[model samples]
Target: MSHPQAKVHRMFEFVEAIGTLAFSEMPNEEFLALGMRNYWDGYFAGRAAPLGLAPAEVVHAVFYNFADGEVARHIPWVWGKTTPAEAIAVRERGSAAALRQLIGDLADSPGLVRVADLATRAAVSAPIEGRVLYAGLRALDVPEEPVARIWHAATLLREHRGDGHNAALVAHGIGGTEAHVLFALALGMRAEEFGRVQHLPKAQLAAVVDGLRGRGLVDAAGGFTAAGRETRERIEALTDELAAPAYDVLSADELDELITGLEPIAAAASTVDD
Candidate 1:
């Protein structure tokens, strides 16, 4: 049988797919209406709001995947456009609006209510040590509205797992850019396309790829070698192990219920333009 933690890990993408609509697919008009410059401004400011005007380096470190300069461009500046409290409110509002648009009356269904309660239990039960983003978010009040509550809980669980994933990458000696490369390859993304989407300069990306090749992680064609694939798998396994604790509060049946209830919502969220 697969490790129970592996089951928890499989739920990661589902929760993220749902939770990120708060910003990822938030209406551009609503974001602009906040006096924000663009999506990146809302993304950086809103997500980091829980940390209360944290320095760019802190956001960069916690976010772990964005290029440092990209983060520096937004933080502190974005705060000037909107206070942390306003960002938080808009984040919840946008998330709730998106969820309602996608799931409609189903947001109030008893199944979702139960899922929200169970997910909230698991999220709040997660240990805070070393989970900077999750810890900060957990310090906020849970939304009282049912749909908003579900989004809030999902966001908590997403960050809890994300913090653990970053630790796993660090332990494996995977740098931020390298992590993106590995993930892109794992998803069968072409290196050129990956670089384009991530906005990685070709020279910088080539340097990282060269470094990976030197470590026997990438082949001459820039694909993962056997060792490379194994390394990625091991890191993910460790991440799953670290994230396992958050789900300890759920019974087997409850866990299954949570997954079942979330599947449709995640599917709905995924239909939005990326």
Candidate 2:
């Protein structure tokens, strides 16, 4: 019997690899500065250009994932000397450069080829459900390395999930910060302690919570009200529905196979620096 949950788990390995490799070290000033100088832009238009969205729309959409206050706080420090457009142009170059350096410095592990092969298999199996994500990733010009290919496939999958998640948030009328706060609450995280990883200001979080409480979605103590839990579940269900297309391309057994094949590589990569 094939299990859909297996596909989700399998796909997560690829997703985790990208997160570890590309984003985990983002808070490190040197890495953050480099990325801000090349990829991320604080300005609406600059950030919106590569995404092909209106600046205003992009600003709203970005907050769904990054939270506005955090982006504002970090941008000045990350790319003080660079313009948004300039940063966009060099984003890929910088990523590739970093990959080259990482690969050079690390011991030549056999996992590279294994992970790349698994990623390619998943990419080929990806269906039209991920069409937008696939197209966006395909447009990236990067070196022909196993690591690069894995990163590309992982990014496509990640964006596919993100696009769906964003749609769900909009559909539910959840403001960006409130959504994060509610989600953290739903997961049993203390709201006051949430900003450590998300980098949101305590005041910004409080304001969002106040609004949520006003709507009866949150309690005064920063816990989720009954309605809030339902809202969170609905949002997750819708997001999963939207992200289902790509996984639908593979058989349960095939996904399991992919997952099994990538396990060693995932373990190895996780030990590497972000």
Best by TM-score: 1
Point to the candidate with the largest lDDT.
Answer: 1
CA RMSD of all predictions: 2.0, 5.1
Model 1, C-alpha of 144: deviation from truth (Å): 0.9
Model 2 C-alpha lDDT per residue in residues 1-274, reported as the tens digit of each score: 2346446745665566653344433322333454444334423223333444334433454535666554554444433454544544444334334444455533245666665665665555545442443454445553356656665566567666666777788888986667668768877997776754355666776787888899898887778889989989888777766666666656676666667755654555555563
Count backbone clashes in candidate 2. 1
Clashes of each: 0, 1
Estimate every model's Cα lDDT from 0 to 1. 0.84, 0.57
RMSD of 2: 5.1
The local lDDT score (0 to 100) that residue 210 gets in candidate 2 is 87
TM value for model 2: 0.69
